[model samples]
Target: MLLSLEGLEKRFGGVTAVSDLSMHVRRGSIHGLIGPNGAGKTTIINLLTGLYTADGGAITFDGTSLVGLAPPDIAALGIARTYQNVRLFKGMTALEQVVTGCWLRRGVSLWASFIGLAEARRAKKATEAHAMALLERVGMAGRAHELAETLSYGEQRRIELARALGSDPKLLLLDEPTAGMNASEASAIGHLIRELRGQGLTVLLVEHNMGLVTEFCDTCTVINFGRLLAEGDPHTCLSAPDVQEAYFGRRHDADRIQSLR
Candidate 1:
């Protein structure tokens, strides 16, 4: 396993956001985490990224404990994630944003840059190259110099993805990467996800799009009301009576959403 969560629990005052969530992500596999609204899906992502401390549970990455680490520390451990809503450096160019991420991943300390050290200059060049490569990989090379806020919603999502991948994560977490995209745009992201998995990147995807789950994810876990409901291949998991009911308000509504738009 590349990532494992055991008995994970998070509480927001009296409300339990996630309860006893236990799921393991296999190495180099695209693992899907799906649920309807308020299913504690994003809560789990926040826990994994260290944005929120867990009230109870264990999170292990590559055999290293990750329960109480800070956000930056968790990110440094090769776990990168995108938000359910796209987050980007709105004032900076897309390439610059990715370059900033690359610098952190490259371990270019602030002290190294403050003194104008020799290695800092070398690192700058490498960071720029790395950012460009990531932009190209995510089909954003043509808009590398555009300010992130000026891009279309889908374009900004692409830049956010490029920025996350610039970290060269061993395990990537995507929270609705295709949320606002049309079919073609969403399909592009799906294709990019396939490429990432093919290159041996383990992914934890939280998506409403059943098509992408069935297409890219090797296995999926369904959650509802902060509890594990089902786990297996996309079809098997999604077809369960509980999943269909919780997912679609009824069993047959599943057919209406071959994909989510």
Candidate 2:
């Protein structure tokens, strides 16, 4: 597995966000994590990214134990993520935003840059060039110089993804990448995700778009109230009676949720 969570538990005071939950993502595949609102999906993402520490359990990535590591350390370990909400540096241009991510992987010392060394200048130039390439990869090259805050919602999403990709991650964790996109925009993001998988990048996708989940994910893990409820092929697992019950009130509402795909 590229990433693994076993016996994971997280509590916020009296509320248990995740409890004894476990799941795995295979290398070079898209794995979907889905559930209704307040199901602890975002909490799990927080735990994995080091924003929140696990109370009890283990998180392993590529054979390394991830518990207690700092967020920067986890990111340096080749794990990168996009937020459920678009997060970009307010004043920075699109290319500059992604360049920050490149710096995470290949940065010259601040002292060297401050001294105006030739080598530091060369490295800075190379990093900017690479960031531009990433922007192009996400179809944002044309908007590379635009301030991230000024872009439309969907456009900002593309920039966020490009920035994440700048880290050259072996595993990408996407938290609702298609959250506010229209159908065509969402489909474009899905295509980009598939392209990444084709290049051997593993992904753990947390999305509510059932159509994207059903069509893009290789495996699906369903959770309810922070507990694992179902796991298997996306279509079949989602079709299960219990899974339907958790999403809707009863069997009849199943069709309504199922229609999302």
Using lDDT, give the best candidate's number: 2
Model 1 lDDT per residue over 1-261, tens place: 998889999999999989998998899999999999999999899999998999998999999999999998988889999998877865899999888777565666789988978888888888898999999998899999889899899888888888888878999999999998888888989989989899889999999998889988899999998899998799999878898889678666766664654
Return the clash pairs for model 2, or none.
none
Candidate 1 is scored at a TM of 0.93
Off by over 4 Å in 2: 255-261
Query: On a 0 to 100 scale, what is the lDDT of residue 198 in model 2?
Result: 97
What are the per-residue Cα lDDT tens digits for candidate 2 across 1-261?
888999999999999999999998889999999999999999999999999999999999999999999999999999999998888999999999999888785667899989989989899898999999999998899999999999999999988999899989999999999998888989888999999899889998999999999989999899999999988799998888888898887887777766886
lDDT of 1: 0.89
Residue pairs whose backbone atoms clash in candidate 1 = none
Candidate 1, residue 259: CA error in Å? 17
Point out the worst 10-residue segment of candidate 1 by lDDT.
Answer: 252-261
Q: TM-scores of the models, in the given order?
A: 0.93, 0.95
